[model samples]
Target: MSETPITISNLNDYIFCPASIYFHSLDYYTDTLTYQDSYQINGTAAHNAVDSSTYSDNKNILQSISVYSERYNLFGKIDLFDTDNHILTERKKKVNKIYEGYIFQVYAQYFGLTEMGYRVHKIRIYSMDDNKMYPIALPGENPDMLKKFEVLIKNMNKFELETFTQENIKKCSHCIYESLCSFSRLKE
Candidate 1:
């Protein structure tokens, strides 16, 4: 791999909250994710199916493994890669809204693959809940997308601490980690 890996600023854009990223940067194991992190785990499994589902040979897909970089100070796993494009991970929740964060996640994978000298063709978002996939191959790495991505990762390196918050949106009603999230206290 190159001395510095490709940048990872998209995560904050994905989450749509710079403060949340800031909280994570504080080295806070903040959430204390447990078996309660199952939704996330399930999303990961869905991504694994896509990453390793292989459209062909000579294109080796990987599971959850960090493609780290010392210079970029970036650390995140590729849910899928070794193909024409990369898929960050799968979305397990049954949602209709298009979560752009999936794109950021895929971009991170593509960034790492490119640094490692692989020709990335696209960034795909696979929703296992709906058995759907959206592939975005914008020429050579879209700069705007990447810029926002790196910005988020940069924010993640800030904040001394973080307090979790939630929306009363219908989506969060059945939250698995409700007991763990700080916001859950207020609901109680």
Candidate 2:
């Protein structure tokens, strides 16, 4: 509502569930009282450690860090950016499968950096689980995906409560909004 740009995290949330975007836009928060998830805590620690290492002894390896793009209205803290080599890396927690949202988030980072005049040659992801890095083929701001994202944002801006639906019941079951979600399939 304030003309603030939508973040890559917001895009990831929308990919997870359209209803999540709607609920978030309304400032409706899910109850986290019953959960003590360690995954989030570990992720934060990992990110901090990486950030510290980058700015401390290995600063030169990363360049053009924490870049923002005003044109696309997206911002991200890139883990590793080698300007001369034209490579960008995004770190992620361990998971069995790499989701489309992860790829798109990295792509958004690429879009932002390129718009700012950095030629990003490659995109990579560091997985905490294996302590290994995986290369991702650069999508280079695919117009099809951009169009879809724009449509989603436009629809979400309308603020229709009914836009929240039980599209993925399994994911909905684990959602924090499950208890308060009237559009849930569990209610049937």
Q: Which candidate should be chosen as best, given TM-score against the real structure? A: 2
TM-score of each: 0.58, 0.70
lDDT of 1 at 15: 60
Q: lDDT (CA) for every model shown?
A: 0.49, 0.62
Q: Name every residue pair that clashes in candidate 1.
A: 9-149, 9-150, 10-149, 10-150, 14-101
Tens-place lDDT per residue, model 1, 1-188, is: 33333334336232643333333333235444434333223354554444565433444555545675454555566665645344334344343544556555566666665666666555566665677766665425467866766665565555333444444443344444444345443466
lDDT of 2 at 148: 59
Off by over 4 Å in 1: 1-42, 47-65, 69-71, 83-95, 137-141, 162-175, 183-188
lDDT of 2 by residue, 1-188 (tens): 42666666566666666666555544324434344223222234446656667434554466325656665566666666777688887776664456666666677778778887889899987777678787877764456756655565565445555545666787766665556567777788
Q: Per-candidate RMSD vs. true structure?
A: 6.5, 4.5
Q: What is the lDDT, from 0 to 100, of the residue 146 in candidate 2?
A: 60
- Once model 2 is optimally superposed onto the true structure by TM-score, how far is the C-alpha of residue 111 displaced, in angstroms? 1.3
